[model samples]
Target chain A: MTVLVFLDPRHPEGRIADAAAPALLATDLGATRGDGVFESMLAVGGQPRKMGAHLDRLAASAHTLELDSPDRGAWERAVATALSEHLLRAGTGEAVVKLLLTRGAEGSDAPTAWVSVSPVPAGARERSSQGLAVVLLDRGYDSTLAERAPWLLLGAKTLSYAVNMAALRYAKANGADDAIFTSSDGKVLEGPTSTVILAVEEDGVKTLLTPELESGILPGTTQRALFDAAEAAGWALGYGPLEPVHLMEADAVWLVSSIRLLAPVTSIDGTPISSSPALTEELTALLHEAL
Target chain B: MTVLVFLDPRHPEGRIADAAAPALLATDLGATRGDGVFESMLAVGGQPRKMGAHLDRLAASAHTLELDSPDRGAWERAVATALSEHLLRAGTGEAVVKLLLTRGAEGSDAPTAWVSVSPVPAGARERSSQGLAVVLLDRGYDSTLAERAPWLLLGAKTLSYAVNMAALRYAKANGADDAIFTSSDGKVLEGPTSTVILAVEEDGVKTLLTPELESGILPGTTQRALFDAAEAAGWALGYGPLEPVHLMEADAVWLVSSIRLLAPVTSIDGTPISSSPALTEELTALLHEAL
Candidate 1:
């Protein structure tokens, strides 16, 4: 079951809508032109995780797309209403909450903002625990393109995710569970929907490394939180224009996102890569504490 | 006013739906992920123009996205039903018909296919007549990237058009009426939503030219029809890896699409270019006759 709430002007707390019914006009630009922004998060016992970070990223995405969205307070109220309704209908164990804001129906200026809370996918947790087999796919753009062409909306998490979806499908088709996109110039970027992280231990000093934000990847909220926690706990950090060889040489590599948290990558292109269970356990504990 | 017809298994002739009401589930991947294919065409006197070409392109787009859609006959029936209903409610004059097929709701294998008929935008004809002030924007991909990376879906007309919409918005915000995209390697590409066309007059021989399909541009149906008509009328034709200089030196330049037919480009980046009213008039007549 799912619960939905729409941010409406008349209802400052939001208007509850039937999830089973048709609720979007066919001509909405979100559906037609994919002119929208979205964020997915996890909730435990009615408490949303990293909501402030998610809301910040969402606002940045909306600003990138120039979409007029409801303020953070409006979103917070809607999210609270949806979560309360969802907890009443379903148990409060764990739920996946999504925030969406579209440019609205064609020729209309009003934006469509909504909150939805639903049960997390059945196998997502298991898959994240088991680790992922990934393939490197060409993203067809160089790393420097994002800075030169802002119209591409490279860093924004817009709803135009067909290429990302296609990459994941292509990976699955090729016997891999997920995809890590690489720039045309052979730089390791990020996964289709997650940020890529590499853990390096040299001379007993541990460092967490991720591709720089200038590489045009979506800034991962969970990754940011984990980095903060790691930094505070005396772990070194590094950002790169890294290559695939770095992943091959790393002690551990992970694909991190909001709902999945951190999914370790066990292999690349059918080749086994080193992964440290001890590090995963320690980082997972650190992430839990950070949250 | 608009008319909608859904391609349904139980209704071979298509099931008509209320266009005013919300007709799409909020969880539909078309709205969420923009995972879908669509084609828009012009209908005059209840007759859809270039339907065969539109259906052909739509099928290709579905193939690229691996979306299982209704067959051509079902789409034809839906289009017919929608146009007939639109004529009854509105008039027998010009209408804009759109065919859409989405990968349905999340977690479902079923596809949602529909036909919608509505009045064309009021200013479309006026804008086509007055021509366009265009700004050239970088597309951030090399021309050869399409062949190297099929996952980019560069040639397919998917619903993930946020970047295209953003490009047009950027152009408008920068005081231009429309945008023409150029490849990262400095090759002339098509417009955001239309195909670019140029006419050259040299040594008393008039030639119509458009960027080569290998440059990763959508093959314009109207441009193809005009090319055939021009050939029949003894005008020469050329395909291009054309540059900006060619557009500037050409006798006439146009942005062609199914609905707009042919729209001339009066200037590029604020500098007036060579534009011939006689060539536009001649080519417009050829296009109309071909249609």
Candidate 2:
């Protein structure tokens, strides 16, 4: 497995290879202490999707943990450089690029980084079509969401992904394809590894929504744009304490993210629904606009 | 600024440095995920106190995480080596040695292992004498504490010290020395950075109780032995829900750990306690028997 790396852009020292997967050293600071940050992006048609938004979120997450990050431009160039090299070879594959940054192998305060690419999840395409059956795991939301003051969540993504991954495993163990979390108080929150549930109201007058910045949910760049497009199209939008029951009653439920544009929900806790296809198509179109 | 690292007794390459710090890089399979286990012990008078017990607890934690540890003989040698080196230096300065083992840091599935030591907090002596104040913070009781059926938490001491440090910072900013986290239901749980609260009963019984393991509290090794000693000495021992009112009504409170045997809690959330010399003396004796 070839992994490339860069620090403040530049090769982050001679250790970074052009396109080879370099062996990464995970130190106490990185693995044992979970002192780091990570970002996963979908590389579509040889280009990094939503690069700026991802970088912005990364910076914010880094700031949250007092972790360091490569400067924006340099990091950007480094990524672009790698992507270009792969493209120059005329090789293309739907890829998942992960940027992982930690406090370093010595357990010191200095930031360590690694970049690696893997084949996009084999099930992703199929999952998008079949959609996800999700349960409320109650881990991710309970960790830090309840205390966040909306709007501030646009921060960089830190490395405390144990809970996130656990949520996914929990869902699988519980007979569900995936999991979503709600606030401890029970307002529908986000997927175990994705964004919130959104759908259009039955009457088609408004695009009922999940709370934005105020929800303390990670600001999904793709989801945010979709909502904006809804408004531009004159579809009224809302954000609130969405009871899980409400999403089921709505015309449609779409799980939005960077890779999968929208994964429709067939049921909520096993309750099936008959939502309007027109609404999903309309919202997805808006998602592109928002992007 | 010199740091000392003790290679795992299983030091993969059979390489162990005699001075300070290990030579190999930490691998990150589980450490990156905070998926490992660790134990901190106190080294005093050229000997590590309660070493067997600490090692026992560490083994239990590893079992909880399902991680493999080096053989006991290797562990003893590593500890013996590190302690002998420190003993030769002979300074009044206290030290903290942290042993971390996660999935390998080379990004291999086999966990990584690393250990290091640093000067202990300079004020430990002062705080032990004058006692320290505590602020109550809310780091909700982990939901899986009961059933003890693999809460990763049983093994997760590897990487999430950030939360512990953050709780400490919260206490400092709130005009207290450290933070004690209570359950969401207002039950007194352990501190975000330490274990249970202790107090002498008005009836003069030297009780050293702790919240039940089911109350989403980590089983504090120090507190466990104290309970046995308290009972052996004719003092009643109890455990279960720790309501805030119960904590506030006590005669004296103390926080126990591997490093700080029993730091008296003079005040909580800014409220002072009536110092109990009997409770202090008895608790100290119990701690001395074990640590």
Candidate 3:
């Protein structure tokens, strides 16, 4: 079951809406043109985790699209309302919370903003505990293109994710569980819905590495939190300029996201790689602590 | 005024819905992930023009996204119902008709499909008659990436058009009325919402040129129809590997779409370009005849 709350001017605490019923106009720009921004986060004990980071990213995405985002207080209240409703309806231990803001119905000036809470999917938990087989697909943009072409909205988490969904579909059809996109210039990038992270151990030191934000990838909030936690735990942190070779040579690799904390990547393009379950457990523990 | 018709299995003629009210579940993947395809066409005298081409493209787009599209007859009936209702309500001289299909509410296998008819926007007509100032923006993909990277969905007209819309917004913010995308490899591509077409006259021979479809651009229905009519009228045609230099050197350039028809580009990247009203008129007439 899912619970929804709309951030409306008429309701200070947000207006509760039925998630199973029709709640959006067919002509909403979010439905028609995908002119919107969204964020997904994990909730534990009826409280959303890393909401500050998610809301910051959502606001950044809206700014990139020149969309008028609601104030932080409104979103916070809506999220609270939705989570409480979900807890009442389903008594959830863990739930997935989503925040959505659209340009609204066609020709309307006001934007549409809503918050939704639902139980975490079984697949996300399974992927995190087991592992994922990932294929490296070309993302069709050079690593350096983001800074030059702002209109591409590379760093923004907008609703225009058909290509990302298609890439995942392509991976599944090609005998893989997920996909990690590589740039046209052959640099390693993020996964279709997660951040690519790899661990390298040298002598007695361990390091966590993720693709550079300048490479036209979304800034991974979970990755940032993990890196901070790992750093505090005496692990080195690095950003890339990484290639496919780096992933192969690393001691462990992970596709990390909010809901799927840290999922180990067992293979790349049908080739088995070194996957350290111990390292995954350690990093996941650190990540959870940070959250 | 607008009229909406939902293509439902229960409704043989399509179910009429109130466009002003909410009619879509917020969890619909089209609104959340933009996982859908759409087509828009102009209707004159209550009949949609070039509907066959639009429907064919819509099917191709859905196929690319692995979506299940409704039968052609269903879509036809919905469009007919929408157009008749629009005519009755507004008594329009011309109306814009849109066909939309979305992966339905999350976890449901069914798809949401609908037809909507509204009066043609005054801006579309104004752009065609008065021409437009267009800025060239980098689309961030290399010219040859489409075929090898099918997951990019370059040739499919999916509803994930936020980047396309952003490009147009970027142009407008920079004092231009529209935007023409150029591939990272320096090849001239189509406009954000229209096909790029240029006319050249050398040694008393008239020729029309557009970028090659292999450049990862959507197949332009209006461009194809216009080209067919121009060829029948003894005008030569060519496809490119076109560069920005070619556009600057052409005798005339225009952006063509179903609604706008033929909107001449008066400038590029803040520099004035050759725009011919006579050629726009001549080509528009041929296009209308074919439609």
Best by lDDT: 3
Superposed by TM-score, candidate 1 places the C-alpha of residue B143 at a distance from the truth, in angstroms, of 0.8
TM-score of chain B of each: 0.98, 0.84, 0.98
Report model 3's TM-score to 2 decimal places. 0.99
| Steric collisions counted per model | 0, 37, 0
Query: Tens digits of per-residue lDDT for model 2 on B203-278?
Result: 6655666777776567787787777777777877777677767777777777888787777877878888666767
Q: Cα RMSD (Å) per model?
A: 1.1, 4.6, 0.9
Each candidate's interface RMSD (Å, one decimal) is 0.8, 5.7, 0.6
Q: Which ten residues in a row have the lowest lDDT in candidate 3 chain A?
A: A122-131
Tell me how each candidate scores on DockQ against the true complex. 0.84, 0.29, 0.93
Docking class of 2: acceptable
TM-scores of all candidate predictions against the true structure: 0.98, 0.81, 0.99
Tens-place lDDT digits, model 2, residues A155-242? 3355555455555665677677776766656677677457775666546467658645545567776676776677788877777667
In order of TM-score, best first, we have 3, 1, 2
Tens digits of per-residue lDDT for model 1, A1-291: 888898999999999999889898888889888889999999999999999999999999999999998999999999999999988999787899999999998878999888989999888977776889999998977898898888999899998989999999888999999999999889999998999999999998999999999989999998999999999999999999999999999999999987888899999999999998899888989999999
